[model samples]
Target: MEEELISKKELLELKGISYGTLYRWKRKQLIPDEWFIKRSVPSGQETFFPRDLILERVDSILNSKEETSLDDLAKVLYGSPVEMNITLNELVERKMISDAARSAAEPFITGPTDYYGALTVFSIGREIDSGDISLDDAGTMIRSMAAAEDREMLRQGVTRLYRKQGVTFCAIISDASKVSMDVSSKLVLEISMPRAAAAFKAKLLPNKGEEEDE
Candidate 1:
């Protein structure tokens, strides 16, 4: 198949993205180096991009802005370690965590798991292993996440973990994270549900041809 190419000027105008932002994303490796295809044209040597890939990546970046940090979005878009998936057994077999950690993580899973869910479990295990949180506390965190109204809400949100002096606190707030939990405790685990359906939508899902259509 002939690879579709889009000019830098066209890309910026089409996506309403600024040149500075584009290069910055490039520097951060949010967009791959090879995607910046520099070639000589009638006007001059100009930068171009693999049409579909760049647009999809840009969409992912824009959609993730409020949902997560740019660094996290970069990881998700580039399939970084945090974005990789592992089964419950594999998580332990690979020594990413102990069997006890997996036991603590089981209560958080409401259904068949995905990469994001696995990452959450792995994170909980790491916190327990490092003594940042106790096994019971980890279970509390997992249960909190699992209590989200739906899988999508749990999958699409920010998890804030705060530590001050000897106290540790964690909260998961998604567009669709609404739920009830004990907040008076030092460990606060609750989901702030989305007020509207649009708020709960997942941005990372592929928006194929969205830019092209524009």
Candidate 2:
């Protein structure tokens, strides 16, 4: 079969890429290296199988949403598409994320998860501003609420709380996590968060012997 060939100038115009970027892709092995054939009797050099491959790579890059540089784009344009998919899946599995949470990380995400993991929710047991309710009054309120069987339901939560530089942090829990009950007085909300989240955000201590909850 006859291979179509294009000059470097023609290639750049067709691919809508600058010459330096194209050369950089070559240096990084992001694209298949071109062959240089030299004949002692004739011209300087020749590059074979050039244009079609470059075009194929450019098409792939244009279609992708990722903000890739020339070299990275060349890598994708030249490398197996499946490797990228597998790498992303591996990252998600390492984070201890389950299948359900993985699905919610949609089109914008390159990975299987959107960094959602379990969080440690602490109740300060008082309003942020003590002026709104005295500490003693807030304690009474909490005690009253905790005494009721439906403390969670009775409390009207922060719908439009005016605060300084704070917002809600959403997270997901592992399927393994559940309420552990014992003959004691506390309810243990066992959770499995990603290592990064558990370490930095969840405020949960490492694996330990937890007291059995009632």
For every model shown, the clashing-pair count is: 2, 1
Q: Where does candidate 2 clash, by residue pair? A: 182-213
TM-score of each: 0.41, 0.30
Which parts of model 1 are misplaced by more than 4 Å? 83-214
Candidate 1 C-alpha lDDT tens digits along 115-186: 556656655665677677777778867776656555554444655554445565667766323645455544
Query: Cα lDDT of all candidates, in order?
Result: 0.61, 0.34
The alpha-carbon deviation from the true structure for residue 35 of candidate 1, after best TM-score superposition, in angstroms, is 0.4
Which candidate has the top score in TM-score?
1
Clashes of 1: 2
How well is each residue in 1-214 modelled by candidate 2, as lDDT tens digits? 4556666656677768897866666676555553222223246554443455456555554554254464544433333221212222443344423333233222223433211211111121113232443333333333332233432222212211112233212112223235232333332111222222212211211111121121
